[model samples]
Target: MMCGALYFTPIGRRDSCTPSEFARFENDEQKGSKGGRIHKNKKYGFKFVLLETRKGYSIIVGTWSGIAYQGENHERIESGPMITIRHPLWTKSDPRQDIPIMILTRAQAEIANDLSVSAAPFGPQEFSRNAKFVFALPPRFDYGDSTGTEEVREILRNHPLHPF
Candidate 1:
């Protein structure tokens, strides 16, 4: 299995969000737990999405508040997940885990690990979790007169790819 890192808006602090926003990821886990869980483990609580999948699937929510312009460090992590993904726009249903899956390669995972977003949604609550799509692009071109990988990065920096 492979893990992929994804980016969204930079998350602030947990206290900044209203109860409703936090419920997306929080309440579910809390209810599932045995105790009347109220608090969440800070480590598991992130403003970003992270997951690794070969066959099955799971949702990934990230909580990062940083800036990476030019799509250099598009995502911040070691390895991204190896799952199929789909973006919110592709499927017009409420954004949830039900979205399609995405297939991510090592290079693509690295790119996702190096992404940065403008601002995180569901503010005051660390970060909001969203459904992402598995992104796939056309075949690579071997044009005689064209920029290489770096230029390609610029071209598809804002790819609508996510893991399942």
Candidate 2:
């Protein structure tokens, strides 16, 4: 699956100074799965979005770091801090056995509608198969103080995945 970031504005708000909210998952499959079951591990101070994908499901984990200004115009560029997809750390057993088939079917349909392609990209066989995938965000360059270096540093200090 392809992954990238997009800029979005909250509804009813239209001010340039208001930093655009950015969620880090977007591509052919995820464009449609805008909202999902969000699970927050408050004890760990982290949260994840449980998105239903065509084949099965995926989980995106991370938190929002801080805001930064971009380009010559110095436009706002806020990001979901250290976002990445996590696959089930499983072996031998099929993960689908645990999920209800009905949920998968609904999720698949949602993705198809989001795609809005003239022709269905996958056939019945593709839908029947079980699959899981993970994506890692590329390394980011520190924008120094412009991106709230001290804030990010503090967040990272307490980041759950800091060992990685």
**RMSD of each candidate?**
18.5, 19.4
TM-score of each: 0.19, 0.20
Error of 1 at 2 (Å): 22
Candidate 2 has what TM-score? 0.20
The digit string of per-residue lDDT tens for model 2 on 39-72 reads 3333223333343322232333333222223334
Best by lDDT: 1
lDDT of 1 by residue, 31-97 (tens): 2122222223233232223221111222333222232244444433432222212222222233222
- lDDT of candidate model 2 versus the reference: 0.27
Q: How many residue pairs clash in each candidate?
A: 42, 0
